[model samples]
Each structure stands twice: as structure tokens, then as C-alpha cells.
Target: MEWRWNAVFLVSFGVVWAAMTTAKPVSSLDPADAETRMLAALEDQYAHDPGNAVLARSLAETYLDLGRPGLAIAALRAGDPANLENPMVAHRLAQAYEASGRVLDAYATADLALARCARALGTADAPSGTPVPRFACDARQHMALSTHQEALGHMLEWGIADPARDARTEVAYDLALRRASIASAR
Candidate 1:
């Protein structure tokens, strides 16, 4: 039921990601050379600031853009514990795992990312007219929720029941998905 809506969201998200990745910028330099330069810069930046969540995320994204999910996974994993717990990093790591054909790992990581997002956003509901968080929390939460739903769908498809499943989580996720859908439609 809810999973059907989740499936639609996941497929749309994947299509957007694929389209974005495939769209090359019109540049005087060769596209490959530009991407290579961007990758080199990201690697250097990440090397200097391994604990920086933003750098780690950027490095992982670059690796993924270059179709090297293995490198992306390594980049995401080789960071500070606090940084590694970042929802965005976890989201990217899950994507990397999926790209590399590691379905179980991807599902686990997406679940973790969803948990991290819930923690970051807190349990207390915001007032109806409250301003959105300043740190891109909305986008982070959306990414985490969509990825987890997608991964959970995959697990069910594979006949695996997640041992971590709970009724509370399912209800919360459904509400969150509804809110996200409403927000996006605005």
C-alpha cells in the first residue's frame, strides 16, 4: 500500500539522479578531463580534511559521478565517526552499495541513515507554521526517508523481513512520506 507510493518516489528519484549524472555541461575542456580535475580536487580536499562531513560527502559524490562506487564507499567509510554518522554520508554510502550490487548492505545503511535523520530532526513535531531548519534538514530527511523506503521495498522483494522493523517506525515513516509529498507538491 504505502510501499507503492514509496516505489514511485524511489523510481522518480533514481531517474532524476541518472538524468543529472548523464547531463554533461557545455565546456571548452573535455568532459572527462573536467570530471577528472574535479575528482582530483575533491580527493585533495578530502585528504586534508578527512573529518569534514561536507568534504567527505563531496568526495563520495564525485566518485559516484565517475561510476566508481567502490571508491565512493571507501571515501565515505574512511572518515571521522561523527562525520560518518551524517545522514547525507549514509545516504550516499547506501547508494554506493546499491550501485555495487550489495543489496543487503545497502538496505542496512539506508536504515541507519533513516535513523540518523530521525535523530537529527528530533522526536518533537514542529508547529504547523514553524520555519524549516536552516541546515537543509528537510532535504536530508527526504533523502533518508526515500532511500530507506526504497531499500525496505527491495528487502521485501527479496523475501527478507528486517529484524529491526517496528510499528512506530512504520507509522512515523508513513507520516513523514505524506508530509514530504505535500511539501513537494507546494
Candidate 2:
């Protein structure tokens, strides 16, 4: 009876070990290979839902991850213009623009996204006791911070002083600060 119990335990352990070894963790894949696989999956989804804003945005992000900012821009542009108002879409587009060295465009896109976020949050004078929502303000602040960081990154990449870079950075910092203050006020 003891031997029979031992045999069952060994078989169960072997099955568990086989399952573990057969199922590879996604993190174990090479970064490049994983990215390629993700891009292919995103592309397949996009093909099935050509007008899907979410899929388009995800595809653009994957392209950006693959260091193909130009393709990211194209993918984003191909999506419905109405979806551009989505803060996430706008933010990703700005990132792609920044990656492609279009600093002004990136700043403008980021600014537009921030504005949309603010608008979504309702007017600034919205009742004194009203609870301030979190997501839009936080997203706006993130977009501003990202724009500022991207500007600095571009400056470092180009190895040259851009007169507008400082101005953009200042504006971004101010925007971020304002957003944070608003959040705190609530």
C-alpha cells in the first residue's frame, strides 16, 4: 500500500513537471522576437477590425516598441480622425512624432491632448466641494511630463541647442504643475 501511494505521487509530480517545462513563459522569449510576435498579432487584429481605434492605437504602440516610429505615425494616422481626441491615442501619436524628430508636432499634439483631458474634466470653476476626478487630470499631467522629457531627450540626441526646446519644456512643466495642483485641490 505504501509503494502504491508513492507511485501515484511520482506520477503526479512527473505530469506537473512536464506541464511546466512545456509551457514557456512569455518573459523567456528574446525581446526582439517577442516584439515581432506582438506586432504580428496586433496586425492580425487590425486587419480584422480595420476601423478599430483600440487596435490601431495598439498597433502603433507596437511599431514604436519596435523602433519604427515612422510606421507608428502611419498606423496612427490611418485610424479614424474622431479617435484622435482619445488622450491615449493623442499621447502615443505625440511620442511617435517625437521619436521621428518632429519636436514641434509632438509638442502640439501633446498640448491638444492635455486640452482634451481638461475639457473632459469639466470647467475649472466646477463647485468648490465637488470631488475632483482622477484619471483625466492624471493622464494630462503624464502627457505634459512625457512631452517635456521627450524634448530633453531630443536635445540630447541632436547634440545641438534648440531655442524652442526650452520654451516647450517650460510650458510642459507648467501644465503638469497645474494639473497636479488641481488634483490636490480636490
Candidate 3:
């Protein structure tokens, strides 16, 4: 799913880049020198190797940098990112949608990206035979920890947490109880 979206984003972004180069401001020489240069370069690239994906991605990123969010997103969307809804793609798509004044779509994409991140974080630490997926500790362990819990874990683990004013202390204690409950349940 993620790979598919990555490809679409790459392509859409590439074409947008090529277009941006062509769409550069007017030049003095022959009036169309910039256009010609842009086209020639794009054509040269397209002709040299239709299978040059790196070039294509570079072109797409270039388009994104040229303030042509529409073209860049389109190029990227042409691949799996549009269909797959990966977090990175969702993040970019949200950006593009926001730039295009599509507030709702932007919000939606942002939400999806957040959800994907959360989901990934949740299932990252699964024990081999546990009823529920385990949390990965120390960034290497994958666990479905809540935001507060995760913060608490990091603070406690690192010993930098202030006992007097930390909101996460209670959260950590609650999580401990929950873990105990789960252990007993199992």
C-alpha cells in the first residue's frame, strides 16, 4: 500500500517539475528561449530513458520547489501514494490540498497521515504470543502506547522526569496498572 502511493507521488511530482522548468519567466533571447530550454531538457530526459525513475522523482521534487503544488502533487499522485494513502504521501497530499485552497481535503489527508502514524506506533511492539500487541520499548520496541503513556515512558526511562510537576507520572502509573491487569487476564 505504501509503496504504491510512493510511486504515484514520485511521478506526479516529476511531471510538475518538468512543467515548472518550462513555465519559467520569459527570457530576453528569442522570447521563447526559456520555454525551449525547459522543453528540450524534459524531452531529452524523457527520450533518453523512459525508465529513469530517479530522474522522474527529481523532476517531481523540482516542480514542488517551483511553487507548482498542483503539478507536483499530481505527478506524485499518479503513483501509489494517491491510492495507498501512506503517511508520507498523505502529508504531501495534505500540503498540496491546503495550498490549492481545498481545506477539507487537506484536513482529511492530514488526519489520515496522523492515523497511519498512530496505527504504526500502536502495533510496533508485539510479543510473539501475547493476546494484544506489545509496545516496542526504547524506540526499538513496538507498543501501542498512548501519547501520554509514551511520553511518560520516555521521561521515566531517561530519568529526566520531574516528580513534582510531571503530568505523565499519573499516566505511567495508570499504564502500570493496565499492564498488570492484562497480565492477570492472560
Candidate 4:
């Protein structure tokens, strides 16, 4: 039993030592160089697994962080269309579209995301009766509303005069107001 215990300890110590020695220290690299390295690694992984939605999203986010919204759009498009149903993917794609001077596309994409959120939460249309304050506090609904608001802001900033955009903006504003009212009531 003593020998067996000693052997186990030695093996665990060796593994830990090997890991500590082999791991690269992140603090040693310059911020820009580290970002470039991370981007290259993610790109390589993406190239090997082109259909990976998570990888595609990561690459898109990295490109966005680097101020390359066009590249971000390309990265997002490289993945499966089904991935767009993911709120994060839709939000990022909308941002990329807006940054690339496609305000209408951004608005449409955001609207689609909001619709998805509503469908997922089974709140496509509010109840016809008295409103429940708790309904306004849903996190998913807040995310959808915020994304829609952002898209509307971009459209308004671009001076695009469209009734659809105006209506969506008003809806987002109302949702936010309701959320505030609910919070204050609590």
C-alpha cells in the first residue's frame, strides 16, 4: 500500500510539473501579438472545421474586435445558416452589417432575431388582456429588444426613412419603458 501511494504521488507530481513547464505564459506576449496569434489559431481551427458554428462565431467576434466588420461578415457566412437562429450570432451579424453600411440588412437581420426570440419564448404577440409586469423582465426578451433598438438607432442615424424601422423602434422603446416600470414597482 505504501509503495502504491508513493507511485501515485510521483505520477501526479510529474504530470503537474510537465504541464507547468510546457504551458506558455500569456503575460509574456504583447497584446497585439497575442491577439494576432489567437486570430491565426482560430482561423486554422476554422479552416479544419468549416462547419463549426461556435468557431465561426469566435472568428467573427475576433474580426469585429480588430475593426474588420467585412471579415466578420465573411466569417459568419462561412458557417451554417441554422446558426443564425442563435441570438448572439444574429446580433453580431447585424452589427457587422451595420458597420459595413448595410443598414437595411442589419434591420432585417435584427428583426429576424427578435422574431426568433419571441417565438422561442412563446411571446410573439402580447396577451390582449391586462399586461403582466413580469413579462417585461425576461432576459431573452431584453436581449432581443436591445438588439432591435441598436439596429433602429443605426437606421435612424443613416437617415433611412422607413415606417417599418420607426415602428420597430417604437416597440423597442415601449418594451424598455415597461421593463423600467416593472423594476421600479419591485
| CA deviation > 4 Å runs, candidate 4 | 1-32, 126-145, 149-186
List the candidate 1 regions with Cα displacement exceeding 4 Å: 1-32, 123-136, 159-186
lDDT of 1: 0.68
lDDT, model 2, position 103: 69
Task: Give residue 61's error in model 1 in angstroms.
Answer: 0.9
Global CA lDDT computed for model 3: 0.50
**Candidate 3 TM-score to native:** 0.37
Q: Measured by TM-score, how close is model 4 to the native structure?
A: 0.57
Among all candidates shown, the one with the greatest TM-score: 1
Angstrom error at residue 63, model 1: 1.0
Q: Kindly list the per-residue Cα lDDT of model 3 for residues 35-100, writing each as its tens digit.
A: 547745864674465444444455455555555668656755564332323344455565565456
lDDT of 4 by residue, 49-120 (tens): 876767877888888777689889987887777667665677779778866767777778776665555555
Candidate 3, residue 128: Cα displacement in angstroms equals 19
Instruction: Assess each prediction's global lDDT (C-alpha) against the native.
Output: 0.68, 0.66, 0.50, 0.67
- Give residue 84's error in model 3 in angstroms: 4.1
Candidate 4 has which clashing residue pairs, if any? none
Worst 10 residues of 1 by lDDT: 125-134
Query: If both were scored by TM-score, which would come out higher, candidate 3 or candidate 4?
Result: 4
Clashes of each: 0, 0, 27, 0
lDDT per residue, candidate 1, 1-186, as tens digits? 999999999999999999999997754346368666877787888888888889888888877876789989988777776675677787888878866767678778877666556555654533334333323345546555564656455454555534234444355446656766676778
Name the better of 1 and 4 by TM-score.
1
